[model samples]
Target: MSSDLFDRIAAIGVIPVIAIENAAQAVSLADALLEGGLPLAEITFRTTAAAEVMATLRDKRPELLVGAGTILDSASLDAAKASGALFGLAPGYDAEIVAEAGRIGLPFAPGIMTPSELGAALKQGARLCKFFPAGTAGGPAALAGISTPFAHLGCRFIPTGGVTEANLPDWLAVKDVLAVGGTWIATTSDIANGRWAEIAAKTRAAVARVREARGG
Candidate 1:
């Protein structure tokens, strides 16, 4: 199930990390992404409004693939599940969180920055991991270098943080990177300012970039 979820994510090639401060904006935001031909969204737990917004999107916009990010503990994981999130993303790897998620059969991707962390996650039965703070972790070049040893392990990555339109091609060009997560597509300020059209436009352009890079 986890592999299948990652496959779907890879097919889309991008996941918008969004934080909707207003639950009311959830449906329209999802509509905008659908309008742009992208239907995946990762709503982060950085705000008090995250759980409700996630539930709103899940219940109302059933076609939108909504996942929860910034999940740090079992509590957040439970909340994410209770709110109907399909998956959970953490800023870093945690053994207990991985165990609990597996116990409950939740699809999860823990953040990995170093080879040691990757090894640990693999030991915990994780096949896909998030290369978080991707830019600070040395961008695509760094991910390529780190992925060499793990290539045989079939470990794939979804690099988040500081991923933008300008550098997306470089990230996607790395064979091991299945997809990327970026907030630049629908930033907090953009949502606050009600810039749905701009967000949709950026989503469309990002999707075009992915297709061009993959020769699709």
Candidate 2:
């Protein structure tokens, strides 16, 4: 399951970390992403409407790989699952949450920055992780430094936060990077102001860069 999600995400090479302010924007956002050659979204739990957004995308645009992010505990994971999220993501590692997700058969990815955290996730049998706040975490340089020890390992990374079209290629150039996460494609202001065309254009540019970087 992890490999399948990894392949799908890598194919597009970007995961839009979306924070939808209203459920009404969900379907249109999914359509915009599809039009831009990207169909993956992590509807963050930062807002009250996240789950609704996730469910709307799932039911309206079944082809989109919709999931829940900012998942901090088992309850949040359960809520995400109930909302039809195919997977769950968190910003930090928690053994209890991971255990619960495993017991429930949910494919999960915990956030990791330090080598210690990476080792811990590996011990927990997690092959993919989110390198959150990727820019503040040293961006591609930080990823390269930490990935050195686990170069032979099969672990892959999804660097989120601070990712942009200008620097996305840098992250994709890394050996173990599967995909990148960013809010630039569809910012809160963009959605609030109903700027779907701007979002679609940005998605196209991001996808183009990913294809160029992967030599696809």
Candidate 3:
């Protein structure tokens, strides 16, 4: 994995995990994020428009660090790669998927909830991970607890699911967290209405929160 990939993601502070219902909205939504000072987005493959959106965003806004999320199998991985995703994210760690990602030279952030899962991800050469359902997984406290013993393992995490502006501070304050993921900034209505200005405002608020939490 290239160290620059992690550095790019970390620089953004927050990675918006977006699920686009309409492929047409992808480019505009990405532009809004960038306009608001964010330069990264993780477009999840949960919708039929995922691949199309990835392609559109890559061509229209190549500067954004685009990642494919909800990638569970090799086929999905291949499709995401073909669509120009710079990285891949899985809801849970699968050895096969992780191996395939590495083979294809794509940086991956697999999900893990327990120490055992984290160990498995590490064995697969994954130093960065996603703590899914982060709030239910005990949120920041859970990450802090795991870091106490496994911080020496050189593992870092991006807390995704359930992350909101309210708890982003607590999550980012944790030493083990590299970044956070959420869709609150790019709501469906904002995209539908072409509310780029509104989206940018929300994004600015989120970024400000991240900076405040980091004491910057």
Candidate 4:
């Protein structure tokens, strides 16, 4: 992982997890997020339009930091890199996938909910990982406990599942957390209905939450 890119992510504090079905909305979505004062997007690879959407953003909205998500294998990781994604993430830890990411030079954050998974990530030299199903996995409390043993080893996290504007503070309060991924920021309906303004509003609120959480 590039230190500069990681720093940029840490600065943003809130990353929008985007999955747009229509490629036509790509640039407009970028515009909305930028308008909201947030310049980051994690385009999930689950949708067929993921790569195209990312490429469109890269060419048309170069200011937005685009990343790939839901990457389950090396093939998707390669596609994400080819699409010009700055980073990539998955919902679960896979040794092969982690190794492939290191080999391909794309900064990847594998998901973990237990110390065993965290150990796996560290063994592969990954300091930053994702805390998935966060709400059901005990949210901030779970992360705080699971990350304690590895905090001194330079471990960091980005808690995603169930993270939202409501509890943004609680999540960011953890010493090991670097950011929170807001799946609620840009939902499928929001994107499909072309609700750019609503998405932007939600994004702006999230940005505000991050600022408030950090006492900025």
| Tens-digit lDDT string for candidate 1 (1-216) | 376777888999999998889888888788889999899999999988999998998889989888999999888999999999998888899999988988988888899999999999999988878999898999998999988988998888899988988888889999778899999888899888889999899889989988988887
For 1-216, candidate 2 gives per-residue lDDT tens digits of 367776887787888898888999998888888898888888999888998898887788999998799999777888898888988888888888888888887888899989999999888888888998789899899999998898787888899988988988899999889889888998888988888898899889988988888787
Stretches of model 3 off by over 4 angstroms after superposition:
none
What C-alpha lDDT values do all the predictions have? 0.89, 0.87, 0.88, 0.92
Which pairs clash inside model 1?
A: none
Q: Is candidate 1 or candidate 3 better by TM-score?
A: 1
lDDT of 4 by residue, 50-82 (tens): 999999999999899999999998779999999
Q: Please report, as a residue range, the 10-residue window in candidate 3 with the lowest summed lDDT.
A: 1-10
lDDT of 1 at 164: 89
- Which 10 consecutive residues of model 4 have the lowest summed lDDT? 176-185
Check candidate 4 and list the clashing pairs: none
TM agreement with the true structure for every prediction:
0.97, 0.96, 0.96, 0.98
Error at 135, model 1, angstroms: 0.5
RMSD to the native, candidate 3?
Answer: 1.2
- Model 2 stretches with alpha carbons more than 4 Å out: none
